[model samples]
Target chain A: MIKLLSLIFLILLLIVGKKRGFKTFITFYLSIFLIMMYLTFMKTGLNAIFLAIIICLLATLVTLFILNGSNVKTKSSFISIVFVLLLVTIITVFIGNSANIQGFSLESIESIGYYSHDINYDMTNVIIGMYLICTIGTIIDTSISISSAMYEVHENNPQLNKKELFVSGMNVGKDILSTTINTLYFALISSFIGFFMWFYSVSFDFLSVSKSFDQNIIQLLLSFIASIMIIPITSYISSIMIMKNKK
Target chain B: MKKYLTLKNILIFVISLTIILFVYNDYFLYKTPILKINNIETTVEGYGSYNEKYYNQKITGVIKNGNLKGKIITVNNVTSTSGVNDEQIHKRSELFIKQSNNNIYSIIGVKRDKYIAILAVLFIDLIILVSGIQGVKTLLSLFVNIIISALAIFVFQSNADRLNLLLLYIFVSMIFIITSLFITNGNKTKTYSAIISSIVSLLVSFGLSYLIINIHGRDVTIWTMDYIEYVRDYENYFYVCILLSGLGAIMDISITISSSLNELIDKNFKITKKALLKSGREISKDIIGTMSNVMLYTCFTPIVPLAFLAIKNNMPLMRAINYYGEIELIIVLCSCISIVLAIPISLYISTYILKKYKKEVVK
Candidate 1:
């Protein structure tokens, strides 16, 4: 099934995106391989959070620079994304440690329950690493969108001041904000639907269900927070960089 | 710095900080007993059968809720540095406690809702502060969509045995597309075009996936799915997941294309259909990679830890992929396909609706 779907996806990408489609296909696989390597490296007992940060930077470079090419937009996007990534990492570590949702949920335990959890690495750091990696994609997407759109706006209206450009970027960010949030919300919900159904099937009450769902909810909320923070910050930074380039 | 000191920004920050501070300290609000750990004494460290290290801690804390308010209790906690199955109980952390026989209390879990609440407050305040009115509407649409989804889940929970869950999801998907687009974009030609294009694209993509799945037949592994024991019909549930997962990206693409094309048309009334199509393709081409990347990461990232665990347990790569990675790959690939397919479908639909229809009405 995976093979057939990938073939179809490749065909569709070729038909619609053509060269860029092929590029996306490669980047997608490259990211997967990168993640696989990150996981393998994590087993060596190096600092998981630090390794995750490096992997995130590498992944961002691959996604933004490779896919979009090294242009002004990509550069500014890269800068803002790194800024946001670092900022979000601090919050991730703090919240992740306090929340202590590092291990598998009771729902997932049924499948992998037989396996040994003695992987010799801190699950808390590993889970925090996952959060950091998970958020980089959307952060890159949001930053690039804002930067590219702001670049266009500045090019079209060279007379627009920095404030005007910043406002325009905000307008664009506002336009995409809802849909972006929707994308994140649905993706998170769908991934965990099985757990939700299980919660329902077993007839767990609301409190217990919410308790069990805390782990997933925290992840979703963190992603949302990251993307939201990226918007204004990217818009402001891109506007400043674009205008500064004009001078 | 002066620009950053706007009244609204100051208000948002102050309000959010106040909320965070209040939530962090308001443990009395909970009916369940909360234990504030004052001391943790590590009692033991040993190796398990797999040579895994573990630690045992004796924690002393004071209860902050229910009849045991302000009463100190001691509980035993076993943990490991890995913190899987058990976590190192930090001093000064609050936990939920349950009373066992002989009136002894055991820690249930950490009280982390205060942190979640703080984050939620920050997220909401930032959205409103940055995006202003659109932020409010976006949140409103989110609230509506969340309620609708909850209702859909409830419907599925009750009717899992009797109903066609896919059909229910299709209906819910429509409501989702309509409510979200309408609330966000308001009542406009662009919104209508987006709604039409998204629905058409969803149906077409879902049909393609269904055909592919059918052709692939029943040899696929469904048992590797989490919580599979509770699912009644694995095929239907799988389809539901594929559809719901792809819906957001599909809608996002369609709306973006339709709105951009509409903006193009609105700016240049004499633009040719060929030019419009070219522009739509250009816009979607730029978006498709990142959008699919979003799908890929969102779907694949959650399973990384599980894959790590499988590898750590010495499961073979192929067997591990067979276990869970295959499912995530399929979900992501199908979503990518839908997102890729949505580009052309939405372009054609929007051009016809926004261009040809407007021309016909003008004539």
Candidate 2:
């Protein structure tokens, strides 16, 4: 019953998201395959999964009011979504499959309480979520802001040429870039205020503390670099897209 | 008369003099001890009482400074009659004692002085210097937020677990929304909507987290000491705190969406839901992307020490990188989940609130 309700809730979420054109219905369908993969590891058998998959397919069609790829203009996004789901399944399989661990289910459930004993560093979903969110946010901001600045520049001087428009964007981007960078920096500082205080309290040398918190630093570096990299790429994407959209 | 005493110059002169007086008072105000810059005992070797031979044996103390600082002061043949354990013996050592020179004493603790008068003068000076109404609003909001966070941590978030701490942060956000909106817009229907919208979004965000954790298998144990610290069922508690930590980002997004949506409606009541939502989506795409990175880096910065470790050791790139993937996963999941969750929840609540006060929109 709990599983059924959760499924219903997920469906509702999809419906709501689709109604607003946010495009998370793909995430919903992908979730079904994930659920199946999870059940397969539970030894629910391929027969039950086949039945479940068929039923889910029909339900998804009924909800979306069409079957596979009906509204897809470019097949690439569709393929990308499929690829992501496939990747998730393949990873989960590698992590939990092939081993004849009968008590795996029990361990997984027991670990849900504290996750202390059996929970290995299986943080794939979470890490991806963070990276996507940060990267996505920064990308949108840079893209749209640069695009807007380009529009203004082009509009002001209609025959200013493409190179001139590009320069204009670089100029405007330069102005607001520092504030945005500072904002992220200060915000990052705020999040680690507690950790810094603790670090200061403990009399560990800089090296020891650095080693102790090695993972956090890497994650930060990755996310920050990702965001940093996205700024120029997104700015370029928006610039080109806007230029193309105009032409 | 105006030339003899200009208000600006007098004020500046008074402020400078006041600061000088305070400094002068600190240096020479009271008969406080002029403790010499003697060496401080930075390192100590504690001998266990079980090592009875070394227990009372006088070892010269090494100091970092003054003449006697590095010089060892060995107390000869001190005896410990109390047979405590070795650790206790080190802990209970009477190392600090009052030593007098020239009828003055160097004590083992800090000197105390109340600086309330200086604080009061500063406070009054701020008011006198900047008495605009906008300043008052800023000050009030700052005070309110400080109080709310304090109350939440001390009163509400009594639990030590980080996950529970996360949950508590969400609840505290309610106060943040209510107080900030009230301060800005006053107690009106719009501000009311802000609070309502905030709460609904928070709950929805939490729901999304539930789905991510349960269905998608987002391991909440990716957070600080989450899996390793437990001898019991602490994962749930850890989840709540992480949920809390991620709540602020969601709250920030929700408020941004709501305020913008509200303004759209106010500017032109004829604006359709589609238009309002479109504006919000346009705004959110930028916010969500930046916020996600913001959230990612926020979690990442603290764990920076962890990265240096990877660099210091000749560890393989794969091995060093693996530790972060787990933590990175949590930061990502929570942030994306927040971004995904906040939009729907804010829009839905805004719609409902708009429906309720369509009549009140006039007033």
Candidate 1 chain B: minimum summed lDDT over ten consecutive residues — where? B354-363
Poorly placed runs, candidate 2 (over 4 Å) = A1-247, B1-143, B156-170, B215-237, B358-363
Worst 10-residue stretch by lDDT in candidate 1 chain A? A203-212
Residue B208 shift from truth in candidate 1, angstroms: 0.6
Error of 2 at B55 (Å): 31
- Across the candidates, what are chain A's individual TM-scores? 0.94, 0.48
Q: Write the per-residue lDDT of candidate 1 for residues B152-246, one digit (tens) a residue.
A: 87888887788888899899999999999999999888899999999999999999988998988856776776666776666788888889998
For each candidate, the alpha-carbon lDDT, in order, equals 0.83, 0.41
Alpha-carbon error at A40 in model 1, in Å? Answer: 1.4
**Model 2 lDDT per residue over B168-197, tens place:** 555666666667557745666656765676
